[model samples]
Target: MVLTDTHTHQYYETDPVKKAELMQRCLDNGISRLFLPNVDSTSISQVMDMVDTYPDNCFPMLGLHPCDVKANWKQELETIYAAIKETKVYAIGEIGIDLYWDQTFLAEQQQAFRQQIGWAKAAKLPINIHCRNAFDEVYAILKDEHNQELRGIFHCFSGTLEQARQIIDLNFMLGIGGVVTYKNAGLDKVVEHIGLNSIVLETDSPYLTPVPYRGKPNESSYLIHVAQKIADLHQTTLETVARITTENSKIIFGI
Candidate 1:
């Protein structure tokens, strides 16, 4: 059973010994594939470090997270877009409107989101959205920018069935993470209805840790738990979930 973590920040662990142990645990649990999305200019090195250490298992993506969108967002994009040219990135992502934190930067966030979407479209790559309380804002931009080149995952998706369908209609995959394992996250109901073909598993590690480890930090090794939760919700086997989701990852990332 080969499982894929479509989104993770396992690179945050800079301690070499602990990093190796973390990767070993992932390998032992059959989580062979992990996609790394760098949040901003500062995180590019950490993301690439993991990619360099595990070239075969870790894939890199470049983007400035919405929460990281400050007054210097233009300069941030200049650096991030330049980095995209230097590296072979699978996607331009972990980018979108995040109004959950501060509503002060809504305009800047929308502008940055549009510009990043343009980058993805121009690069012929997918995007990884990080929407929070600004789904409407994000969705609006997505609609305005919708086209053949507009595609990617809605990372850490925890929306309603209607919203899931709307995203599916856009030809993007829903990135399901550890939140689905929460007893009352209400994502299970949506997952139970959304077909597996439109879904991909993620851990978003160092955050959104699944149950049994909800209070602790998350890692890619815990991806199996998310996969298992989906299997249970869909009434399928773990192996089947692994196969289908990994295949979906390959189709999306083309790797």
Candidate 2:
């Protein structure tokens, strides 16, 4: 089964040597395609460098992350817009409202989110949302602006079934990942009810590693475990899970 890691962070530089080794490990393990999300203005060059290094394997998206929104958000958005105009990014991503870590920049975050959504619409590219502890706020913005024209994936989706339905209604696919393997995580239930087509596979690497490797650093190779868990939850085979999710990814990313 060919696995597509729909989301990953191969750009963050902990150690170039170790990062290269990790990328090789993922490639060796059948992780052929990797989609990267921009963290902030500071990381755009790093993300672009990775994409340049492996243009065929790594696809990068341009956007400002919600957590990075600050008083200088206007400048950040300008930089992001300029990057979008200069590059052929696959999507406008990792942008949304997040009240989980901090709320000081709530208003700024919302404004940045809305602006990036407009940028996506104008660029004719899909969006990759990063919603956390601000579902209602995120949903409200999407509900107001989302139409048949705007579409993308809700990266690391961990919402209720009703929320899943609403996201689907907005023409976005749910990104399923390592969290689904957690015993207490309700994503298995979401998968059971929503099926595989409404979802796509991701690792969100170096963050949400699957069980057995739960507390460890995640890599694209770990996506196989995520796929296996979803297959088990849906009472299907891993090959089927891989096939359907990969197809769903191709459709969303136009790869």
Best by TM-score: 1
Pairs that collide in candidate 2 are: none
Q: In terms of TM-score, how similar is model 2 to the real structure? A: 0.97
lDDT of 1 by residue, 42-130 (tens): 99999998999999899999999999999999999999999999989999988999988799999999999999998988888999999
lDDT of 2 by residue, 16-112 (tens): 7977887788787778889999888888888898898788889999899998998889998898889888988998988999999999999899889
**What is residue 80's positional error in candidate 1, in angstroms?**
0.7
Candidate 2 regions with alpha-carbon error over 4 angstroms: none
Off by over 4 Å in 1: none
Tell me the whole-model lDDT of each prediction, alpha carbons only. 0.94, 0.89
Q: Alpha carbon lDDT of residue 109, candidate 2?
A: 93
After superposition on all CA atoms, how large is the RMSD of candidate 2?
A: 1.2
Most accurate candidate by lDDT: 1
